[model samples]
Target: MLPEVNATRYVTPLREGGSLPGIVEADNHGTYVVKFRGAGQGPKALVAEVISGELARRLDLPVPELAVTHLDPIVARAEPDEEVQELIRASAGANLGMDYLPGALGYDPVAHPVEADLASRTLAFDAFVENVDRSWRNPNLLIWHGDLWLIDHGATLYFHHNWPRAGNVAQRAYKWDDHVLRPYATNLATAGPALAAELTPGLLEEVIALVPDEWLAEFDFPSAEQARAAYLGHLRTRAAAWPAWLPGAAA
Candidate 1:
């Protein structure tokens, strides 16, 4: 579980970020890297980060610790930067934010280890099932202090728009041989029990609420109601159908 840190204390802006990410330092002097709502990518992506990111973590995949941060730009001003001052000022009244990934550098999938391969496949499985936001070029994998870290999950399960009112349950077909998917089918199957354990209705509801109401306008979800229904239904269907061909299916 992540401790609630006051975002005003340690959230400093990254000068190079297109979405204006910040360095989040807690009172215990622990640090994390964060991306905020009013910054670069906007609310929809942030919503995806919290919702999909948390769900993936619950599935026992290798995801960095994440938390929703409430920030005060005035406190953020103390971090000291000529450029970030403008960004912090520009963003106010936004509570939708995430804890940062510390000591991580982005990398290509081929460069990572076999464990990294398993993690990526599990991620792709989650993406395929949910119609996710990750891709080969934009895998969002980070190498932090010698370990692989997964980040930026704002783009998964995009099928809500295609059939918003269709069903409370959706079964979108996925290409098993996708560059990332083919290699990790076995890993995904192995991880199914953990994934199944976490996909409860209560958890899904809480994840959905993490998205601020204002972000609905940016989402392509047909109508707000339909989008919400479809997104939740998609996850449920995916969880129900956890691949059966796993090595130890009887276990």
Candidate 2:
């Protein structure tokens, strides 16, 4: 389970994303980018951040620390913006909090070149996860302290949005041409196999268990355990079908 903390202060809103995640100070003395349960995307987005973000971290990828933040909503009283106050008041329970990375710059493929090795691995990872948000227009990556960090995984795991049709898209192909790091993913063929090998069923189950039951309760499955099984099944299927969906695998 992710460490839980009480939100001490609502700093400001990050208007870049549709969900309106905010910079919040927590009782743990941590500054986090808190994805609220009241956001338009709702708690499911927070679940994605946990499952996908934590999965990325276990894959030897750089992702900020993630936690379960308990919001009181009363903290919204200080906010002058009605929209923000409404959002805060709506999310009076558990939210997802990602450790804030200060001084990080948004990734620009042309300006900050990534090595072929890392690019291939990143592309392969994204492909296996079926992430459709890492396009050049909105890379969803950051460069901090001369290192690449992945963020904003709320867009991954789209299958959960419609449970009944998940099987139909589990093995869906990923297009890499528009991928922000496509040019540098020269070793994707090998990267695909190597990374997929890391996703053992045990590892997948472990990662899925990290999601709080409160978030998992939203799924239509008979129980949260079944929901976890669904995610595990989808990912295991996708991981093994890398030959079909992993971009550049044929090359």
Q: Which residue pairs does candidate 2 place in steric collision? A: none
What TM-scores do the predictions have? 0.66, 0.97
Over 2-117, each residue of candidate 1 has an lDDT whose tens digit, in order, gives 34555546545665556768776655455666666666556666666667777666655667766555566776557577667766665554444444655567766567654634
Each model's lDDT comes to: 0.57, 0.89
Off by over 4 Å in 2: none
Clash count in backbone of candidate 2: 0
Clashes of each: 11, 0
Highest lDDT model number: 2
Q: How close is candidate 2 to the true structure, as a TM-score?
A: 0.97
